[model samples]
Target: MITHPKPQELTEAVARWIEEIRPSLDPRNAFLARVAANALAAVTRELTMGEQAQAAAVERLEALLGHGGTYAALNWELCEELRAGQMDTATPGLLMALRANVLDQLAIDQPTYRHEAS
Candidate 1:
């Protein structure tokens, strides 16, 4: 089971990764450096809130599907699509992992937050 990451942990990890990558940057590449840092920060933010966001997504999907099922029963392609957000700049591998964790949790909890269809 993947426990949710604390916001502070995500921030600190991202900061450390940035610092580790900083020394490789040239003065002429500062713009690129900032962009990379920003991307990392965005990923970190997503990680911190990933569980809640994914739970909400699942709820939305259940409503859309008009039925309930284990996360295992969800369309794998749907899960994959949500895992890979349409961002151009950075690889969202970590975000995908987070999404997977949330799905696993949802499977265990058998969460049902969908509205009844009229």
Candidate 2:
């Protein structure tokens, strides 16, 4: 049996290739290559961490909302509730859940980013 590269591996390889070639590129192309590499790195992170992050988000949302749901459904419901003033910073567990969800997403999207809380 043959094994294929995982999606994360493929993204990492491409990102590495972009970095290897970036120094040889013209300034504009180098900048573009950097952007591409950054995007690929984000993709790799998402492929590796997205499921766990999503599951955790769902769990947090479920506990906060006191119900079970798919992430999208729960996320939408959360947004609706917030918009309608049904939930807010005053809501128990709301701020903590939102903070956790944002931090998890930042781990995938911008691992190097430093926030005030960090």
> How much does each candidate deviate from the true structure in C-alpha RMSD?
13.7, 1.7
lDDT of 2: 0.94
Q: In candidate 1, what residue range of length 10 has the lowest lDDT sum? A: 109-118
lDDT of 2 by residue, 32-104 (tens): 9999999999999998899999999999999988999999999999999999999888998899999999999
lDDT of each: 0.57, 0.94
State the lDDT of candidate 1 residue by residue for 1-118, as single tens digits. Answer: 3447666466667777776787788875766776666666655656556567666656655554457765446556445655676322243353454455555444434344343421
Candidate 1 — which residues are off by over 4 angstroms?
A: 1-28, 70-118
Q: Which one is best on TM-score? A: 2
What would the TM-scores of all predictions be?
A: 0.42, 0.96
Once model 2 is optimally superposed onto the true structure by TM-score, how far is the C-alpha of residue 24 displaced, in angstroms?
1.0
User: What's each prediction's clash count?
Assistant: 0, 0
Residue 21 lDDT in model 2? 88
